[model samples]
Target: MRVLFSVSSWPTHYSSMVPLGWALQAAGHELRVLCMPSQTAAVAGAGLPPVPVLGGVEVAVHNRLSYVREARAGQWPYPWTPLHPVTGAAMSTLDEFDLGDYLRTDGARFAAASAAGHDTAVEFAREWRPDLVVHDPVSTEGLLAALVAGVPAVLALWGPVGTHEPAPVRILPDDLGDSFPRHGFGPFGPDLIRHVLDPCPAAVAAPVRGQRLPVRYVPYNGPGVPPGRLPRTPGRPRVCVTWSTALSTMTGPHSYALPAIVAALTSLGVETVLTATREDAEALGPVPATVRLLERCPLYALLPDCDAVIHHGGAGSAMTAMVTGTPQLAITFASEQSRLAERIASSGAGRHLPGHIATVETIQAAVAALLQDVAYQRDAAALRRAALDRPSPVDLLPALEKLAAE
Candidate 1:
């Protein structure tokens, strides 16, 4: 089977797809990944064939993320107040923090992005006629491409879907753009996805309301040689503080609280590794002696070696820590990340500091809790064991093939 996978330009979303893409390639299937032009080298780095589609909306993505960060910081809202009645208790899926105008703004943003990417995708898929199109949940363009190409498409999840149990899916829009015409096709729904591949462990999984396949979270930190840096185990409890590279790469690094976090953790006598890009590292100015600044490392390879992980509650980072059996400290800035953090904290395996309110003191205290609490370690181990039980990507091939056949 020829599998064509698509994603938004963000490396974080692309990172989740790598494991499954590699699995498909290993299974004697031909695979090509179509991403925004900016991610071409990254796609190649992951050892996959790259199809750089036209009309890359990277600037739009950057602007949206920047807006979300600013909104979370109370700098300004996304055209409206964020505290809506729907925002009660549930975290935004770490999607772009849309403030209050979530549906219309987000819908329009999706439509615009889809319109930008869909035509090229449709043209290519029409010619390629791939057996399957597995797309990042955000990229409905891929789904339309699949529709026009007469192939099945699956929605690959980075986190749990937003809907609660007994998911009531609505009809998909009649058209995303000129390319995706819904007149001849059957009814579509909000996401327009036929299958969902969920990677979160049951302990933290949101209730799945639709057709979902359980796939193990395989950590892929892009195509990089593992950097060798030993965490000072047996000497002092080694704690890692990190932010999602996507957040930093799209917006700026979390400049406000990072240095303070380093100082407080180092002062607390714990060895800390601040894993960041070289640019972000330089952005931090200087760090304490007790803190090690690793500019680049394969996070999946580095995470298991740590006693605890502290980061911006990205599903990738959080699950990496969880599957490694390391306790976590989640300093969440967005709604989805905040929810993921809350789940980990409630599970006794980690602590959370809302990024909006996260100060140096809160970060220091959360790290202390993650490291000192035996229950955290114990619960982390239990969670890891549970995560291990999910079927691996290779193991899901039979089911996926069946879907493709249908």
Candidate 2:
């Protein structure tokens, strides 16, 4: 079977798809991934064939202000943002981009490019006739195109879906939850937040509503592993701190309170490794002698070797730590981060830190507790055992093969 996977241009989005793409390919399915042109090399690097979509639109001007700030911060525009610099600029430059007056008004060329990408994807699928189409949470255009082509589509949500469980989901909505009102408004209207929550405005979930789609959760920007191997760690109480690399681009290294965290962890006699993009490492200022700065080490590699994990509470990081039987101290930045933190806390594997209010003192105490507290470690082990009981992607592949045959 030929499987077509679609995602926004962010590396975080593509990272999650890599394992699945590899699995499908291993299962003898031809896997092709569609992403923004700029991400071509990245997708290729992940060992998957790249299928360009979105008409190679360059939507940089719409986010000129953000781009300037990012440039000043030593970062460039990536498609992690909603009205992403790339997509917005594409909207401005294209004649066919249409998401209503708001999206199209940005520019004619941008509009054309957006529409062209979606239309082209649909036409491509009609001609190519892939057996299955998998879309990322934000790929509204791709989802629509798949629907138009009458192929079975599954949305793989890399982040929060916003709506609570039990809510009827017809199509994936693009709601960014309740944080929009907090940020200033201009081109990003309130609807932009709502739109992010459900990207597929027209998807009807009649046959699919209660039937859950396969949401294979993996880390956003995971440690690029060494082939078939995890990272090597020594015999000591290890502490790991990780955060979204994308956030490093928007805000500076999330350094409001992590320094205090390091101080506290050092006090606890724990060895720490803070992981982020190399750019963030410099922006993060100084690392304690005890704290290691890692560029790319598989998280699962380090988790099993750790006593505790700390971070901004991304779903992938939390789960990796949990599956590895490591307790967590989650310092969340966004609404979804907070939600995952809450889930971790409720699950008894970790605890959450208040947004923006996370202090070094609080983080220090949490890490201390996580390292010394037997209950936290016990809970982590319990959850890890539970996770191991459930079918991993590797275990489920055979079943999917049979389902595809049916």
Candidate 3:
């Protein structure tokens, strides 16, 4: 079947969707991916074919106009009207951009690009007559077009659905319940659904409400090429520290807790790999040269050798640590993050660093406890076994394929 796969952007969003996309392609399905133009190269780097959408033009214009408006009025997103601009700072790193803000800030330009994405997809579907359309939730612009053109659409949600579900598309959870933190999935509660997904239930009733597909939470973050062996650093067990671009932006990985963590880990004789941006690392002050700092390594590559992981509860990062059978140290940055941290601690996979009191000492203590206690690792490994025992991509792909074919 010919399929038009749409998403918010590539590279950043690709890892979450590529495993499924590759499954469809390998099974002889013709698929074309659509995302923002800025992400073309990253998507291509993942070894997937790309179809660039012209949405970035509006994103660019909106950003500029927002600056102009912010300077003139000093109002944020101008909430009272639809002309609100969702500035970069106002958005969370994960699922940050909003169409309403884009529309309000860029006006006609945003409309034109959104229309173009719809038109392009519709035209492609009308010509190729794809059997189904699998869209990323953030690409509602494309989903709108698919609905107008009377095509079947399924939304692939990578993170928490954030309390809202767009219409005429299926909401498939990548991770849910207690497993959310263990697997780095969103902690989307029924309340979030009431707030975010319920507003337009009618638009999605037929496609989503009653029909929920089994979740597919597999992550393709395997160690990249060479998979070269690195010399093991023998020390008091090791713990891995990582941050998603969102956490890095939202709370600054260096927040006030850095010195405490670094000091604690050192005192425990545990080594650390602070995986984040160079700027974040610099902001963190003096680091023991022995502590490694990696800017762009994949999470999978880092998890295998670690005894435990320390992170700000992003679904992808959390899952990578869980799937590897390593203990986790979740530091909550926001409400969603705090929920995941609690879930992890409750699951016995790791401990939570209260966002309200995440001092250097609190962070240090959590890392020390995980590294020194073998029980956390034992429990973490058991949870990993449970996750592995559950349905995986190998099991989920066929089911999704059958759905598409039907």
Candidate 4:
């Protein structure tokens, strides 16, 4: 069987699918990754064949435009229009506006950006004639190509299911309506997505729609040298601090809280290891002597030795910490992230702090609680076991094979 995988330009989104691609290749199936031209190097680094699409354009262009538009309009970085109290309560107990806002802003923008690659991907799919196409949710081009080619398509989720209230494609702006018909499909709906491969552990995941296939969460932090044997301070707890690589680039420097985070850790006198790219690190003018900063270091390598992790609430960062059984303090600014952070806190494995309220004192308090409390550590261990107990990507081969056969 030939399998084609499509993902967005973001590293976190695409990296989540690498292990599954590897699984298909190992099972004697041919595989090729369809991604933005900018992401070709990253896909290749993961040891998969990359077929770059979207010409030379990058998705970040649209994101930057949206950011500027929001800023100019005096809206939140990524604003959610509040629903009426009566309507909001009627929708569901949890806030549905976040998902609605995501579809309006990020989801719609992503679809527009991805539409640029639609013809290119369809052309590739027609030539390669793969039996199956697996794609992350935002990669609408993948589904379009698969539909055009008359092949089965699986929706692989990065974390928990966030598009449950309204099907993602259904809520897309009308400008995208034409793209669907061009591929011989009507407005996109749940039927177009054959399966949802969920990696989030049940304890922290939102209830999924459609056929749910549970897959173990595997952490792939791009290609990087392992931070060799971190030396621990005797009897002192070590904490890892990371801001997601994409956040700063999307929202700009004003969103950075690492300096405040480090200050809090220093006040508590816990050993702190800060990991970031050179660009992100350079944004921080100077580093204090108390903090050890490593550039381009993989979290999988750094998190195991640390007792707790403080991060911007990115799915990759949260899951990496979870798989390692490290407690977390998630400082989130966006709606999707805030939702995930809430789930993490409720799971007994971590704490969530809204970016607006994450002051130095509060950060310091959260970190100290994670370190001193035995419940957090114990719960984190349980969550780790639950995640590991899920089916491995290779184990899902039979199911995919059956789908392709049908």
Q: Which candidate tops TM-score?
A: 4
Give each model a TM-score.
0.82, 0.72, 0.70, 0.85
Ranking by TM-score: 4, 1, 2, 3
lDDT of each: 0.70, 0.57, 0.56, 0.76
For model 4, give the 10-residue run with minimal summed lDDT: 166-175
Give a tens-digit lDDT track for model 1, residues 64-166. Answer: 4434444566653123332222222222444434445654765466557656677788888989889999987556567878888888888787754343322
Query: 118-207 in candidate 4: lDDT tens per residue?
Result: 878889999999999998776777788888999888888777544463322121123243577666687765556667888888788765
Q: For residues 171-241, could you state the per-residue lDDT of candidate 2 as single tens digits? A: 23322221112222222221221111111111111122222433334443443752342344465577887
Which ranges in model 1 have alpha carbons more than 4 Å from their true place?
54-56, 59-113, 161-188, 229-233, 246-255
**Model 1 score (lDDT):** 0.70
Runs of candidate 3 exceeding 4 Å displacement: 10-14, 54-112, 145-151, 159-210, 221-227, 233-235, 246-260, 354-356, 372-375
RMSD of 2: 9.6
lDDT, model 2, position 194:
18
Order candidates by lDDT, high to low: 4, 1, 2, 3
All candidates: CA RMSD in angstroms?
6.4, 9.6, 9.8, 7.0
lDDT of 3 by residue, 1-406 (tens): 7767776643433366777777777778787777777767766776667788535333323333333344344332222221224342433322244545655655555555555655566566667666666665445534444454455566554543332333211232222112322223235232212101111111111223334443445666533432344456765576778765544333333333545666767766677776775665676777885577777567787788888888877657766676687899877644445555666677677998865576666777887788778888887887677656645544665655565565
TM-score of 2: 0.72
Candidate 1 TM-score versus the reference: 0.82
The candidate, 1 or 2, that scores higher on lDDT is 1
What local lDDT score does residue 309 receive in model 2, on the 0 to 100 scale? Answer: 85
> Whole-model lDDT for model 4 versus the true structure?
0.76
